[model samples]
Target chain A: NAGVTQTPKFRILKIGQSMTLQCTQDMNHNYMYWYRQDPGMGLKLIYYSVGAGITDKGEVPNGYNVSRSTTEDFPLRLELAAPSQTSVYFCASSTGQGYNEQFFGPGTRLTVL
Target chain B: AQSVAQPEDQVNVAEGNPLTVKCTYSVSGNPYLFWYVQYPNRGLQFLLKYITGDNLVKGSYGFEAEFNKSQTSFHLKKPSALVSDSALYFCAVYYGQNFVFGPGTRLSVLP
Candidate 1:
């Protein structure tokens, strides 16, 4: 079974452009998260949702937004892409919260110019 | 605040040699530790985790990590390194309600 699937494996956007990174999980996990990975820095959480209709800000959530309409999908939206927002984005899900092992998707590489 | 640290930016080893990737953490109360590996253009994959079991935890890809409470460290180790094992490794700690990852260390195994 495909645990987690992310769309638009790669994308290039002009400054101020908007886009959404789609994420879906077939494991029926209750927890989902969005994270960005930079060159030297580790993964930084952007947004997360514990369940459907519930979402929360992560450490670095300024340029992004997220919505969890159903347990299977949680998408992250970048309202206005900036050079600083160019990074590889990853989507992850877990069956429960609090330290549980998370399954990550292949990842979406976004470049802003 | 909870945080994780990988003191080494890179680690080099020859094939068949034992390898160690250092990791340390700081968090209040109990901590949930994890190790993940990433290839050149792929996402992070769970290697192993220490929840509340034995201090030494073994995971996929013949990788293992030891949890040392006194040292606040969870170092990943492999008995014998393989060329295919070359990749980036990350250490993470879960405290309070969130997981914080370390900067990551690159491991290169030469044949």
Candidate 2:
């Protein structure tokens, strides 16, 4: 099984451009999360989905959007990208219940100029 | 609110020497703690975790963590450090229906 996968390993976006960071998991986990990692700042939660069609904002969701149409996919959308949004984006999935360890994707490195 | 703290920004140890990476948490109730390791240019990899039952938890790469309830700490330790073990380590706590991660501590095992 692939576990968790992310598309477009690297990308460059102009300011105000729009794009989507695709994430897919073969584990069929019910909890999926999107996090952005910045130098020295650690990882910040962007958005999350408990299950298909159920999404919620996390600590840092201002410049992003997410939709979980299926249990295996949780895509993060970046509309009107800004230079400050340039960071390594990681997608993770975990089984529901309690305090389960997460499986993370390789991550998408985006540069907004 | 749930918070995680890794007091040291970086830790250096010589190969074959015992090493310790400290972590502490602050929460109202029980804390479900986890440790993740990140190599350069890669995603975070699970190292070990403390859910319940045993206070000492063993994980991958010859790593283990001890959870001290009275001290409110869960410190990661290894008997003998390896140069390949150099990486970034993160501490996290499950709280308030979500997880809160620490700033991270970089471990450098010198040869």
Candidate 3:
């Protein structure tokens, strides 16, 4: 199985520009998550979904939005890009049973200029 | 709120020497802890997890972690370190329906 996959491995956006980051999982996971990693810092959860059509904000949900249309897809939307949003974004999925371990994607590096 | 802490920013060890990476957690109830390793330019890979049972839990790549209930610590250890073991390690705790990760500790196994 392809575990988890993300699109546009790298991207550069200008101030006020908007973009969407796509993520998909083939493992039929019930839980999906979006996180950002900054240099010398741990990952910060932006948003998460327990199932299709159900989503919630995470620790750092500001400046980001997410929609889970299908069990396999969860996309993150950035309405207005800022330099602070410049970081490596990762998508992960899990079965959400008994606090299962998460499977992470390769991640997308975003640079906002 | 649950949290994780990796006191050291970087740890250096010589090849073939025993190594340890410290992690301490703060949780109100039963603590569910985990360890993940990340190589350069790659996503995190699960190393081991402490759900319950033995205090000593073994994981992939000859790695193991010990859960100390009293100290609230889960430290990763290896009997003999190898150059390939060098990577960034993170400790995480699951609480309140979310996972809180530590700042991460970089391990440098000098050959």
Candidate 4:
């Protein structure tokens, strides 16, 4: 059913470069989240949306931006990438509010040089 | 602020032996806890969660976690470890608006 689909599984960017990590869910979930995983650190929330046109900042939202223009898409943007932004990014979606089991995508590994 | 902690950085166990990965959390209101496993070069996968019911929650791949309210802990356990069980384990707590994740613990099962 392609629960969650993320494009450009891997990427490399020079400092100041910009890119977008695309995410879409077929589950028709209402909540979508963007997270980054660094070595020795668990996932850190970057941004999230409860529904189309409703987005919010998460634990670590600096250096990134997100837009939820449609129910099926939530894309994360790296306006000006930095070395510290290099990490594995993940996209997730859940059916209900707080505490719902979230379904995750395979992941996008980004390297900033 | 809501937070999650995994006291151990790494856990080692022999195949066929029992294994435990410790986790603890703190939140203002009722906490919703979760466990996730990550394989090398992959995304985190949901293992189990504690919403409102049973203290013991069983999840995929024969993994289970016991939720202790008094201790504010949700420890993941498996009886008979397999080499395939080796991976990174994360504990998370959902506050009203966000979910906070632990630093993660690496579990290695040697044959």
Q: Give the TM-score of each candidate.
A: 0.98, 0.97, 0.98, 0.97
lDDT of 3 by residue, A1-113 (tens): 88899998999999999999999999999999999999778998999999999999999999999999899999999999999999999999999852699999999999999
How is the predicted docking of candidate 4 categorized under the CAPRI scheme?
A: high
Clash numbers, per candidate: 0, 0, 0, 0
Candidate 1 residue-wise lDDT, B1-111, digit = tens = 888989999999999999999999999788999999999888789999999979999999999999999999999999999999999999998787787899999999999
Off by over 4 Å in 2: none
Worst 10 residues of 1 chain B by lDDT: B92-101
Q: Per-prediction TM-score, chain A only?
A: 0.98, 0.98, 0.97, 0.98
After superposing candidate 1 on the true structure, give the runs of residues whose Cα lies further than 4 Å from its correct spot. Answer: none
Q: Residue B36 lDDT in model 2?
A: 96
User: Between prediction 2 and prediction 3, which has the larger TM-score?
Assistant: 3
Number of the top DockQ candidate: 4
Which segments of model 3 are wrong by more than 4 Å? none
Measured against the true two-chain complex, the DockQ scores of the candidates, in the order shown, are: 0.80, 0.72, 0.70, 0.81
Q: Which pairs of residues collide in model 1?
A: none
lDDT of all predictions, in order shown?
Answer: 0.94, 0.93, 0.94, 0.93
Is candidate 1 or 4 superior in TM-score? 1
> Candidate 1, which CAPRI tier?
medium
Estimate, for each residue in B34-86, the C-alpha lDDT of model 4 and write its tens digit.
99999987778999999988899999999999999889999999999999999
Q: What are the per-residue Cα lDDT tens digits for candidate 4 across A16-105?
A: 999999999999999999999988888999999999999999989999999999999999999999999999999999997967889999
